[model samples]
Target: MASPLKVVILGGGTSGWMCAAALSAILKPGTPSSILDLRLIESADIGTVGVGEATLPHIKEFNDFLGINEAEFMRKTKATFKLGIEFRDWGQVGNSYIHPFGTFGQTLAGVEFQHYWTRAQALGEAASIEDYSYAIQAARGQKFDFPSEDKESIKSTFSYAYHFDAGLYAAFLRDFAEARGLKRTEGKVETVALKPDSGDIASLTLASGEVIEGDLFIDCSGFRGLLIEDHLHAGWEDWSRWLPCDRALAVPSERTDDFPSYTRSTALSAGWQWRIPLQHRTGNGYVYSSAFISDDDAQKALLANLDGAALMDPKPLRFKAGRRKKSWYKNCLTIGLSSGFLEPLESTSIYLVQIAVQTLIALFPSSKPGEPIDDKLADEFNRLIDIEYERVRDFLILHYHANTRTDSALWDYVRHMNVPDSLTHKIEQFKRRGYVKKYRDGLFSPPSWLAVFIGQGVVPHGYDRMADTMDDATVIEKLADMRVRIRANVDAMPDHADFVRDYCFVPPAKVMAEVSK
Candidate 1:
């Protein structure tokens, strides 16, 4: 039998542990036919960038794949249900809309609901496009409920994610991964040695003078890229001109009484502020461009706009807005912040990590002795990771480029700045008609684009000709009916806070005790 593949993951926190847990669980590390020998190296001195608190609904699938109890995970992570994200003042000041986890009204006669809504909107007969969405209604009402399994039911139209403590989540996964035969070393990597023949990563030397050798290395080292960039010299691609938000000040605030079921991204001068409400506290941050705003001003802005009393001093983070030239270079695969950063505008940081881990597992390489790791596998992996990053990049850029906020130089510059041809084509297509580009796989689905386009005032000049199949009066009636049904359904659901209390409420005393440990 071929020997098991030796895999060493650099760094810990969310990405490393997630990879560890998933790899250990799926590959069955110590079994008779064990395919993987996995270990992770992290240090007490090196801190993780644990600011990612909001997540996409895909997280549930990851957790479910690990067979984790949802309620228990939530309790341990201090999580709360997230229906969608509510954006304020991105299109223009005081304008608000939700990028829901689900679709708007159903397709009509092979034409999208957006086309029909556009036609109705032209006639001034339809309400805001937000009216037809079950998720938006539920979010607006501060309600929570599990999506129904019945596809025909309106309640089934929406999905949910979570707002949790990132630090706690990593710790939770650490326990999980360790239980499944993942060996974790509490030391920092001091140097990386490369093979003279293949030039791939040969071994990692720790500060404690211990050397660990592995066939494959996964870099989750955040921003620095550690093995992927520093050691392997996988180039960087700078999207700073288009994205430009290079600095952030994140701080936790006291928990508020109002427990909404969605994250809120409120646009501010020079940049934006994100409010993510967890079970224990509200996660708040001001993501701003250092070139456009001073760090001192950004810190003051974050403190002034918080929903509750500040729990801790604002923690500053600096990053560029782009990705590595190659996510998978040679034998090292970069995941999480190491691969790239598109900011957390749409809560896609965790999703990106999840996708990389999933993709790596899907295209897992051979472990046979004397056989080279197929370059084709690495090529395909890089291709997929590139697509995911580009898609997310375009989506995040849309939030800034489509805005009309003239109050700050940051907003003004992004409003008129040149974007990628791919994004420009999408914008033009949507504006000409209510058309959204479809992807066979990856993110920023039609519904997500529709929400951002319409929400940000990118009104269509025409609708799909097929939308005219339905008479004007009938379209208006159907629109009104959808609104009524969504409103009624959301109203019937339990309050978000109440639902959380019943489902996964973590006591403050318990949280403190756990933290002390």
Candidate 2:
């Protein structure tokens, strides 16, 4: 048999551990498996940004693929179920709406439900599109139920993710990986030694003067890209001009009343504020533009609206929104924030990392590229990631550009700014006919587009002409019945707080002066 490949991953935050955990679970530990040897290096001194306590709906598949138990993972990570996201004051100030996980109403009488809803809406005989979405109804009441395996059930219309402590999540995955024979090195990387002839990394020198060698390298070094960028010199494409908000001040607080089943993004003057509720605590942060808001003011704004008492003062982080020119180069593959950061606006951060890993596994080479890393493979990978970035970028920009918040300079600038042709086309297509374009392979689906576009007041000019084939009165009656059915499904779900208590709960911390023992 051919020699097993040695894969050394740099850094040990969420990305490193996730990669380790995944590879370990897939390959036999200490068995000289075919083309697999996983190792991760990290330092306790270097702090990790755990602000991404929220996640998208795809996380379930990732966990499931690894055979991880959802309840155990949630309990260990202090996680709460996430139905979707709620946009507050995004379309217009004082206006709010939810972008739920699942689809809206089912097709009605040979026409999409939205079309009939729109036709009735055009005649003042229908309610907003939210009425037809079971997921949206459930989210509104702060409720949750496990999505059904049976596709025919209305519960199948509901999908959910998780809201957890990012730090604890890293810890959880670290255990999973270690138990599977992935070596965990606790040290800072001092230098990346390269092969003078091939221009590929040969070994990494730890701060302790120990050098660990590998056949291939995985760069999980956060935004610094210690191996991919610092060593290999992969260039970056800065998108701050298009997405100006560059700083984030995050803080965790005691769990407040009424744990929300969805993350809340409330628009602000210079940028926006996020409120993420976990089973243990609430995560608060302000993603703001340095040009418009000072760090001092940003921190103040982050503290002002927190529902619970502050546990720790805000810790700030700065990042540019963009991707590396090449994610795979020579013998190094960069994943997570090291490869790119598209902002966490849509909770795509963790999902991005997951995709990168899955892609690496699919494209895993048998030998360290006997000649050179396949340019075609690298090119295709970059292309796909670029689409991932741009598509999500546009969605985030939409929240800014399509808003009516005129209270600040930042809003004024973004309100009239030009967007990419692709996003522009999408918005135009939706506005003209309520038609949403799904990517050949990308994250958001049609219903996601409808949720945000319709929730934010981008109603269609007209519905499918075929929708008129149905009697107007019948269409109205059917829509009414659908709303009733959706409401009944949502009303049967358990309360969000009760679900956490019974399923998985993490108790808050307490400080005392004496030891019971």
| Model 1 lDDT, residue 429, Cα | 92
Measured with C-alpha atoms, the lDDT of residue 59 in candidate 2 is 88
Tens digits of per-residue lDDT, candidate 1, 435-510, equal 8978987787899999999999999998889889889899888888888988888889999999999999988999
Model 2 per-residue lDDT tens digits across residues 129-223: 88888878888899988888999877788799999888888988998888878888899988888998999888999999999988779998899
For this target, which candidate reaches the highest TM-score against the unseen true structure?
1
Task: Please give the range of 10 consecutive residues that has the lowest summed lDDT in model 1.
Answer: 365-374
- lDDT for model 2: 0.84
> Where does candidate 2 have its weakest 10-residue lDDT segment?
508-517
Whole-model Cα lDDT of every candidate shown, in order: 0.92, 0.84
